[model samples]
Target: MLVFGHCFTKGNYTIDAALKGLCTEEEEELERTMMAYWANFARTGSPNGAGLTEWPRYGAEEEYMGLGVKRQMANG
Candidate 1:
């Protein structure tokens, strides 16, 4: 199922709340986009299979994509 969560981020980035001083228009956009993609995946079990950019599945790699337009890790 397609889903988005604070997950390891905990209550910092939830569906109804975001980190204090961090919740802004930019965050709203991200949440909206996540919701859209999440719904699509939930319904189809595939995200952007065609006519869309391929979103890679997560791996054990320490680095992952982030807000800075580059891959970064939690400690970065």
Candidate 2:
């Protein structure tokens, strides 16, 4: 299974730290993108911001951001 969440891992002396060095450049980029989204959401009510992929609001199309090897907007 293609599991995620490694990039979002936190804490100083935890499994996340131990596996921190194992992240590839792509994974690191993913982390930056996700962090940007979170920070933007915290600063504003929406996650959409400049220089990032446009995240559509949840609607009938069921669109969402797909965080993975390559981050992009996806729709169900």
Q: Residue 7 in candidate 2 has what lDDT?
A: 56
The sequence of per-residue lDDT tens digits that candidate 1 reaches over residues 17-74 is 4443445554555555565557778988854444334555556654443532122344
What value does the lDDT take at residue 20 in candidate 1?
Answer: 38
Worst 10 residues of 1 by lDDT: 67-76
| Collision count for each candidate, in order | 0, 0
lDDT of candidate 2 over 1-76, digit per residue (tens): 2125575565644777567667777877877777788999999989989998888889998988887777777788
| Clashing residue pairs in candidate 2 (N, C-alpha, C atoms within 3 angstroms) | none
In candidate 1, position 46 carries an lDDT of 57
Q: What lDDT score belongs to each candidate, Candidate 1 first? A: 0.47, 0.76
Highest lDDT, which number?
Answer: 2
